[model samples]
Target: MDWYPNSDEQLLLRTSARFATGMAPAVSGARWFRDLERGDVQGELTGWPPGPTYQLRSAGDKAARRTGRALLVGIPLVANLIANLGGASGTPLGDVPGRGKPDEPENEVHDFPVMWAAPGSLARTVPWQLDPGRRPEDCVTDLVLTDRRLLFLATRKGSLAKADILGEFARDAVAEVRRMKFSEVNADVRVTFTDGSWVRLSVGNPDNAERLGQVLGGAVRMLAESELSEGQFDRVARFRADLPKTAHPPTYSRLRSGVTLVESRIPVKAGSGLFETHSILMDDSGQPAEPAPGDL
Candidate 1:
């Protein structure tokens, strides 16, 4: 019989040659290719068009399937498994309670909490006497800031089931929110309540740490300037805690070139009971040099 090349046969030949030559280095390092080179040709065909060419085509098809599986099936499964294993995970937006749906009526604006527990850790912790049944590892918690309160809710890890109500500090109970440096690029925050209970939390990123400081600092300033009863003022003053002496007030000025400059001070530790100032700059239109998205 005389041999004649069909379109499929001709294209396959071209593709096989191109891929083998172009990917020689990578393919040569593969065990399959090494085995083929070592004369293991029973499972891998030998000869033209039906040999290495066929093997290459089959391998390509398998690689495509593996990539697709990784994207469509493997990733989500692995993520879910990790979350269930008490690795870091966040609640889905849809699952968050009392935050109205798209069509529902909006409540008054409430800022998100500045710092909370990292994923895989307990949301809040109390003395063992307070809750003998709860262990830090078994719970995950979120800190929420509402107009009325700074709330901490602990939930069972891997599920949103309520585990315990850790603490709820009304705005009046907040004594101070201090930014403590942990590293050059990261910080931890401490929230002191009037009752003397305090919580320290890690802020995962520097930007978030700064925003937390700004928002809480601004809130304290606003409260200080507002008209309040003597009792109310004392409560708010607890949250202020000499912030005016430790941190410089934000300032605004216009340059001769018409670019407005806004300056603010951030506190960094100098020594025991001492802090130095770090300057932050922003434009008059309210854009910071380094963008602080949710900061006031």
Candidate 2:
């Protein structure tokens, strides 16, 4: 559980961050080009474009290669517009790479207010180094949540390099964590700071993304192995015994109804550097049970 933020800090949650360029939160949507850099949530759409996106469009690559990539990125030009039009809330919103005019120039700004800080907020200070658009292809980043702080770590992808602690913020600095179900596979989260500034982040794993929201937002109570009752402990032990050796240790949490949810992550069989979560719910009798109302 030790991390760059603090040795001995309990590692509450960790998730793989966006790796492909298509997962960028700065992509255009209904909130395109909205600047939150000055903490002005209603400010004009004058946000600065991410430089790396522009670099891709520079005279370096062949015209055909650039055009081909653009089509892959722009076909929809804003899929969420259908769901979020008129500034109303929607659910199960699909994911978007970048959205704009079908032939939108690559140099244009595509910042969404949820992901771009207008000003004077903590999100504005998030290091560009964590941005996939700006980082190297083999680099990997992780957003780590612990009892004391929230931070990002950088590591060389598929390498043995030690993870580097890039940046961190005191837990108190976070004011809210919202699950954005509208995203593709329901894997996006909006992290808001105490000053009313927020940034949208896409966790590569949907289960991890939901866990980050539920735990950080206080919607459910996370429990440790020691907190389990004798019966529950035995059930969990047997469950873990049957999991693959590569499976991560199970995490326990209790809903308001006291139903225990135990979940674990295991590597995908394809070994494609991805993971999926497996979860089970138990009642007080330590028997598998269906989720209770409001327990989801």
Best by TM-score, which number?
A: 2
TM-score of each: 0.30, 0.66
Cα lDDT of model 1 by residue, 9-116, tens digit? 210000000000111212211112112123332132222122221132345755765565445544323332222221112211111111122121110011111113
Model 1 lDDT vs. the true structure?
Answer: 0.31
lDDT of 1 at 30: 18
lDDT of each: 0.31, 0.58
- Candidate 1 segments exceeding 4 Å error: 1-136, 183-185, 195-197, 219-296
lDDT of 2 by residue, 1-296 (tens): 22333555655777766422322333432232235232333322234334332222323434555456556544323322322222112112224342223122221233233345545657766655555555667666778888788888776645545678767899999988866554444556778889876676767645566678888888878776777888888888888887778665777788768888887655453333355455677877677766667766
